[model samples]
Target: MLKRIGYTAGGFVLIGVLAVAILWGLSVGTVQFSLSQIFNIVMDQFSSPLAIDDPLNGPEQTIIWLLRMPRLLMAAIIGAGLAVSGVIMQAIVKNPLADPYILGISSGASLGATVAILFGIGVMFGENFVGIMAFIGAMAISFGVLFISNLGGRPNSVKLILGGLALSAVCSSFSSFVVYLADDKEGIQTITYWLMGSFAGAKWDMLPFIAVVVLVSIIFFWSQSRILNMMLLGDEVAITLGRDLHTYRQVYLIISSLIIGFVVYAAGMIGFVGLLIPHLVRMTIGTNHWTLIPFSALGGSIFLVIADGLCRCIIPHAELPIGILISLIGAPTFVYMLVRKNYGFGGE
Candidate 1:
């Protein structure tokens, strides 16, 4: 009872923090807006969705509604998706180091987006062609990993990881080769920026799709908490208990891949949230997926919102790639956690 009450209180606290961070995020960037002004604008917009003129200044409305809101929302959504993906992957592979990219999703998406940018494939999809191709590439590589891992024998955690790493290398090498052969300086720069990851491309049109995918995936995984618990118990133990985990693992992988595909398409390759957030939540709470999943989602959302805010204001008159900032912050924090023996990779 106490634990449940504590978790509920923590959830409320996180939601409050997320709200403040969203408002703070709106106030960040080149031109600053106050929280009260932002509040009024949001309330006014909600009250009158079709109003041509908002109470805030023209530029303020544009920055808050058109720019910062979508980006901040995307940061939260992407963070939650990646963190949930991390939790699922860790359970599927039964490995502490497993992350969203463990199945080569990011590399495949990068390859697809690169090809679309350089070769002009999938242009019929309109402005989102690159994202479309990225989604396709991510799914393709995910299935490829599954197939390759099963080639030798029954696919296990080690085999799956090896297969994914091998395919990731292949996709990366091909992507580099394409870039090298193209020799388009501008396109090369675009690819570099895309790989580094930014929420600058967030648009209102894309938000609905991203929101639906992430939210649905989170709910679905939460519903499967029992199976997830079983997965972490090892295949032999799971089978001894009259439950086969192989099929369920594959299904979970496909679902995770779909979540990651949309995220990569929406926000490029933001890293470490997947690698870091789940472990942080696991350290605080126990390994129960029911508790770990929701906390990780909320914690990850908060983490990314703050990260995006820092990225906007860290330098003078410029924004850094969110991916770079995450690495910069996450690497040191992860090291500290690694050195601290209190939380021994869910063994505590």
Candidate 2:
């Protein structure tokens, strides 16, 4: 009972933190707003039709509602999706080092974005052409990895990882080739920034698709927690228990691909959240998927929200790319986890 209560309490705390982080994120950047002001602005949306037209500052309202809200929400959603993807990938391959991009999704997205940004392939999508191309790239590579891994025989964990790595190299080489051929210096600079990741392009129009993909994937994966736990026991053990994870693994890959592709479309390539959040949650809550999934989702959201907030304020007059900020913060934290032998990563 106490353990259950503790878990429940922890969940509430995380939700509270997420709420605060959202408001804090809104308060950052050049124009700042207090929590009360942010609250009033948000509440005004729910007010009666007779509500005054100018309840809050005009530019501030635009900044908070139109800009920061979507961006921060995207960060939270992507973070949650990536963390859950990491959890599933780690379980499927039985490898602690696995991450959401272990299947070459990131490379594919990068390649697609490179093509669109440099070659103008999907410029028809206007503002979202790069993101659309990235989604195409990610989905293609994910399915390609699965197909190649199964070509020799029944796909196994080893083949999947190897296939992903091989295709990732191919995609990276192609991206490099495209970049090398491009003579547009400013376009190259744009590609560099996009590769590092940013949420500056986030808008309400993109939220519906991204939210649906991430939320649906999260719900579906969380429902499969029992099987995921069994997967950690190895195929032999899982088979003994009458659960063949081979087919399920492929389905998961597709779902993860969808979630990851949407994230790439929205936020470029923010890393480490997926790789780091699951391990952190596992360290505190043990390996039970019931607890692991929800905690990891919330924790991932918090991590990204805080990271995004830092990116906005860390510089004097400019915002840092969120991907770079996460790398700067996550690398040291990851090293610390590696050095401290206490976490065990399920081996101990």
Q: Which ten residues in a row have the lowest lDDT in candidate 2?
A: 48-57
All candidates' TM-scores? Answer: 0.96, 0.95
lDDT of each: 0.89, 0.87
Q: How well is each residue in 1-348 modelled by candidate 1, as lDDT tens digits?
A: 998999999999999999999989999888888889999888876886633344544776777887899999999999899999999999988888889998788899999999999999999999989889999999999999999988978888888898999999999999999998998899989888988889999988789988998999999999999989988889999999999888888899999999999998898888889989999888788899998999999989999999999899989799999989999988898788778777445755
Tell me how candidate 1 scores on lDDT.
0.89
In TM-score terms, candidate 1 sits at 0.96
CA error at residue 305 for candidate 2, angstroms: 0.9
Predicted candidate 2 versus true structure: per-residue lDDT over 249-333, tens digit per residue: 8998899889889889888998998888999899888898888998999999988988888888889789999989889888998
